[model samples]
Target chain A: MKKATIRNVAELAHVSVASVSRYLNNKAKGRLSEEKAKAIEQAIKDLNYIPNLAARQMATNQSKTIAVVVSNIDDYFSTELFKGASNILRVKGYEAFLLDTNAEQQRERELIKTVSSSFFDGLLFQPLGSNIKTIQSEFIHNIPTVILDRRLATKRWPQVISNNVTASKDATKYFLKQGCDDILILSSEVKIASTRRDRYSGVCAIANPDQIHLIELDEESYNYVTIKNKIESFLLKQKVRNKKTLIFSFKERWLLAFLPMLFADGFLNSDQVLITGFSDTKLVQTILPEARLISQNPYLMGASAAEILLKSLSGEDNSKNYEPLIVPAKF
Target chain B: MKKATIRNVAELAHVSVASVSRYLNNKAKGRLSEEKAKAIEQAIKDLNYIPNLAARQMATNQSKTIAVVVSNIDDYFSTELFKGASNILRVKGYEAFLLDTNAEQQRERELIKTVSSSFFDGLLFQPLGSNIKTIQSEFIHNIPTVILDRRLATKRWPQVISNNVTASKDATKYFLKQGCDDILILSSEVKIASTRRDRYSGVCAIANPDQIHLIELDEESYNYVTIKNKIESFLLKQKVRNKKTLIFSFKERWLLAFLPMLFADGFLNSDQVLITGFSDTKLVQTILPEARLISQNPYLMGASAAEILLKSLSGEDNSKNYEPLIVPAKF
Candidate 1:
């Protein structure tokens, strides 16, 4: 049997080929009547006509799709950021393609390369690598792009990031004012991400070298046993010294992992220890009502990134001088 | 400036046009030497060549892409499901496009219509509507589809869902065994989703009509004020009867919202109320350590769904009779 064509659908629907094309391409919003659109749809269904999107995309020079690449998908921060971007992109009649790198640098690099050369009109990236030149392919410059969350070493694109330094410094100051003599900072590897490094730098600026103690864990490989051993040793030492320690977590996952163990050990209720972190979900607040959290507005960041990318794609933003847009985090 | 073509890249790299084509189409694995591939890539970059993915897709007759449409993006359940599906899809050389309906039936219908007629190789849908015939276009039949989490009225497609009836029944029996006379079920609209209705039915099978009190809220519009007022009245009635009440929540979001409020109102510690619900996150366990949760393995469900879809797409599973694969939830 011969494959059904656009002309066949047009003839069966009793409409012009242009009408069927318009409906298929999603260009018949206000141009075609509802009755005509329904007839075309019905005719296409009856004829088992599947319009080749690749062919249509070539004709229009647009896929009406945007790609959002994040480090990981199974987290509150990633999902909220994606939701914010998709909310705006969807309103603009563009589909948002969410790509997850699983927080692997190699995967992030490959995904960026693949998405850059694909048919997506624009890209919103939350990269794991701090150096863009090392991670991104040359094809990245070919697409209109906006960076989200973390800043790269080179500022080639517009960025939407949280004020990690200010928020961390402010949180540290609050801890000091509360007479927190010892600060234990639990974080992922700081060198790979600007967000982590900036946050660590902020705490160091206010806290003395002796007052700060850092525990850096590789998130990909670190398990509960490792986390428990590291944290237990730290807490034991603090207990021996009778230090009033403030446990500062740089990521929500760290807090989630540590808090339960701390509570189980009866260390959470003791006056010698306090807890705080950068958390996107109310889960932390729900678990420990007294724990102050540094909340980054990921949704707003995602929306702003999408807005900038859309403007760039539309040729409204032609300036080469790109300013980093910092969304403040609340303590 | 003139546009760079495949011939220009081939000439610059001292390679054949077929080699350039193979590299552009991502078909160069083990086929092209590392040195030759590097030269081709460098030459393409030097000449500023951008390959048209649309044309390549047409030539291959495959986009190497799958669409995973869910009700919402900013949730643990949705994200885990997507991650599970993408983990498998990515390994099989396919890109997963995540589309969010935001729990809107209209948007779900429109998205289904658009994705069905588009270039996706398969679809993994967590639908909002109960009737597939009404919400889906006839074009949906043209694609290999798999349903996740929820079941539709028609069983035309394969589904990967939790054992909602069995889990809910087990939970209900546990609640009854605790000598609880009054049971309050907090759920979203029961009629709209099979999961909710199945859970409700499971509880109804064991508990007497008078023993159960249900509060149905529209998730899209419910606020703190409404939740508080409804809970206050329910508690007041339960207090008058001196009833031992079991608060059964059908969703993790509801549990998160209600737990904080209950604790604030000084009702959490009372011996009169026991809490348990369906939760995908460890947050609930962290907050209420003693609370028994019905945990659904969304990741497993998603992985299984993808496996089925992939098998169907590869023509490895040609059987018309598809058994609904049930991933059991834990209590």
Candidate 2:
């Protein structure tokens, strides 16, 4: 079997080679239609083609500035990552600049366009839209880049991820071993993202799939009042949690928004309801000492990502077969 | 008095026009000496000169990108600012980028160098260093930029402040009215800056200067444990909790680090010692509702700064006499 190329993908997808080239270069400019994009994606998946990004990187890149693109600059998770990565970059005398996607995929696309034209040495990215073809197209092949906290289908771009799945499994097991009868897993919104999918799977792996109940936060709108009201109704439908019950949340915001509301509704107490989540919030130690949580240090993850990017930027490491670093979470 | 040019400044400072140009353009490549830089600053002040940055901007300007530079991205203050600005910029269709200085002035100098060469349209800055002339020299006047949360001697550049002075005064008066006999001001230990100077002056305006005890937080090292030890020893020295004692902190981190350790030592109690700070922290609401806090909303400040910057960028408001917006803090 021979290696697939852009020409081969274009032939299989039934588009012109020029169109394929434009799409691969992330220069579609909305000219590539949904149908064409789907066909191209399918063809690429079928072909297992990795864009020769490294060759491009090596040719035109003598860069010093590293750009770290995040979904939102203000989000606690993103801030931690930015802090970690920027600190490392600063010590190495490399300039680190930031671009905010505003938590919108459209903005993410726009930012990639802006950065692609800029003189950046490398990239540390927290992906917003998970299209592998789009990723390949927007991210220039040779620019030493590492995808932060995201899992993609293609192994072309190495990633640094916190093992959310293993941590989720361990959190579920801890409650079960403590004689909790019923378990409730609460995640932010309804997304088929790796964080939610893996955490749910990790829970189902140990517990009975039927017994495990999953509740979404107010997915449509992130109104905490709405989420609180929904939780109130949901808890009432269960008709009083008389047995030892454990509720798992995926983010700190959920815990903060739900805990006091639950406490007010007389549904939460130390005796029956045990709450746990994933965060190392400073408030946890002071306010909610009884609640258990898995500390997935995003700072460390960001620093690691920057380190890899800097290594690649320095041309010290040339091998493309970089292993995905799964940062472990602590209970 | 006639207007002074860069040439005039160069002659006044006993340097060449190129050297003055490099300094003003922030193009000084480790060549501008400390003594010469000081002389240039003094010359600018002595001559009362403002660089015609607008003319420069009009001649060589095609800017759609706004670079927001902050001292620290992860700080609650900076995050709120970034969120507010980014949100507004997104709605206005302007590309907003962020650069973190890690709260270091040197890093800020480095970041400015990178951005100046790029084609950014304007700036929304939160200056960490309080050197007004340095700011004037480094910040191009024509970029339609707004100085956020920092005060300067010259009124050449527009500003939007959260009114730390007014807020601090109000907070101090509220406590003094509540019969807080001994008000202990706990500020992060560092060199004198605008925040500290204004806040301290604000506190002094209402209370007896001698009665106000100001303590420097272990600012030299940000090690929370070292701070915890120092605070512990300080609290032990003051055994008299008979009077209404108020511990006023400047930042949230100080409150969080000190409260937990103090609680463990059995030094803090709701009945005897009262706690108050300047933050709108969610945890503060949840944990210590008894504590009084001045909510100087950073989101609103950030949003307002972006609005001002956008207005200037469009050249719709050519008024250099724009009044500084002092966002008032609420209890």
Candidate 3:
């Protein structure tokens, strides 16, 4: 049987398609007579007319579409951090669109092209740890973009990020002040593109370069369990009678692995093993509320990113000295 | 310092800007001598020209753009379900841009306009539970779009969704065979929508209307604690000694509220009380692993939405089909 359309309903009801549509939408607002309204409703019921939401959307051109490209979906940092951007964008009357790079650089490049073609007024990119520099050039010319969570090697574009250097330095200092001399830093190679490098640099400022246990986790090669065991065994082997461990991570991927190990090793009993990490997810609060965490205000970062992009989109002079906005981390 | 541009590098190397660009891009291959390549690299380094990712995309017209609009970001189903769409869109030669309606019909209409103005090739919209008919009509005029998660009331476009009637009926049968005489149908008030209605019908198909308990949760005034307590007391006061309790929720929001009450009441130990709900989130696994969950495959739904949109964008007639693709529950 052929599917019924708006025209069919209109024809059967002996009215214009617009009137049928208005009646169906309840936009007629009593402009149509009572008899006409009932007839339109009956026609709709009899014909089983279903309107296409997407097709109707294409008629108007004054949409405020903004695309956000991030690394993963499961990460709380990615989603929670977006709260800031979403809140501001909503007030600005812009609809926020999300794109996940899934940590692939090629996919990131492809995403840029796809999002740009979509006529998005602006874009907010949170590149995978290592690929920030790889896609740096693509962001410059085509659209107004703000790089969030990651830092560019060259100071050419607008970016919003946490003060990784100072935050990491402070976190490491806290560990050092707690009388733990040898600390291990479980670092994400991806974060090196952003504050990870700065945080590592901060750690280097305190401890001897050799003293820093900078274990680089290969995201592509290791799953959560494999990395968990590695962190556990590494801590166990350190025969320093103190058995003090301060593990730091800029990305949450490592912590998902770290939490399971802490439970398996029976180290979750107390703060005996000092393990601190970055990110703010509801799960983090529910699972281990006591764990020391570096709360980089994602909401603020998102808002800032949106603000910068809007300014750029408004054709602000590229050479103007718009200072790089750095949000401090809350411990 | 004047930032180095392609033109500056070309002049310094005694070559055309195109030659300089090709050399910088490493597209030179065998066309340029090694000495020339060395000189071009030197000039590029001296000039400090940065490449733009968005501009690079303009050459191919394959911006690889895919717009994904969920009714709201706060809804667990919409975001989690988007995972499937995001994965598929990313894997294919496309990028997914997300839009959040905040569940407002007007915002959805505005989103359509914003998306069309941008460089997006197609759109995937998850209609608002409230006012879906009006939102559906907004997408009828232009651009290729694919609807996800719900069915349209009119046959104006194609939609991807679960086999609502069959799934709901199967769930109701599971409860009936479990020997639950009084099954409670817990759902959101937007039940007039097809999916919820199907679930209600499914319950009516097996159990007596008087024996079934219907709980309608209104969004405007949701007091979860009070509702849970009410349900708990009602279950305890059942006159029949053999009366097993079965709770069927429309989605996880109700489950999140109800399960905690059961656990608190110490009723969680009784197998006589079967708790199951429909939703698509990892939260189900984390909260109550034993509970039978209707796992709507969001990632797959999203991917299919992208696939359908891609086909339509490529000029294939992908409009108005009654047979929505059935995305089975993983659990």
Best by TM-score: 1
Task: Evaluate model 1: give its lDDT.
Answer: 0.79
Which ten residues in a row are the worst by lDDT in model 2 chain B?
B52-61
Interface RMSD of each: 6.6, 18.8, 12.4
- Top candidate (lDDT): 1
DockQ of 1: 0.26
**CAPRI rating of model 1:** acceptable
Model 2 per-residue lDDT tens digits across residues A108-207: 7776765654445678889865567766677423456799877777666778988877888898899899887767878854354566677778788888
Of candidate 3 chain B, the 10-residue stretch with the lowest lDDT total is B52-61
Q: Pick by DockQ: which candidate is best?
A: 1
lDDT tens digits, residue span B20-81, model 1: 65676665445888998999989989988877565455434567889999987766788889
Model 3 Cα lDDT, one tens digit per residue, A1-331: 3335555776788875445545645444367778888887888789766543221222121235577888765565776556678778878776676776766677777777655544456788887764444675444345567778776754556778788877778888888778665677777673446567777888888777656787787645555556666776777665345556677776765665455445534554445467677765433433355666887677678888888776665566575444577877877
Per-prediction DockQ, in order? 0.26, 0.08, 0.07
TM-score for each of the candidates: 0.80, 0.69, 0.63
| Consecutive 10-residue window with the lowest summed lDDT within model 1 chain B | B52-61
Question: Model 2: per-residue lDDT, tens digit, B207-239?
Answer: 897668777764325566555565556555555
Model 1, range A216-294, lDDT digits (tens) per residue?
Answer: 8775664666666787788888889888999999988777666655664556667888988998866677667778899
Worst 10 residues of 3 chain A by lDDT: A53-62
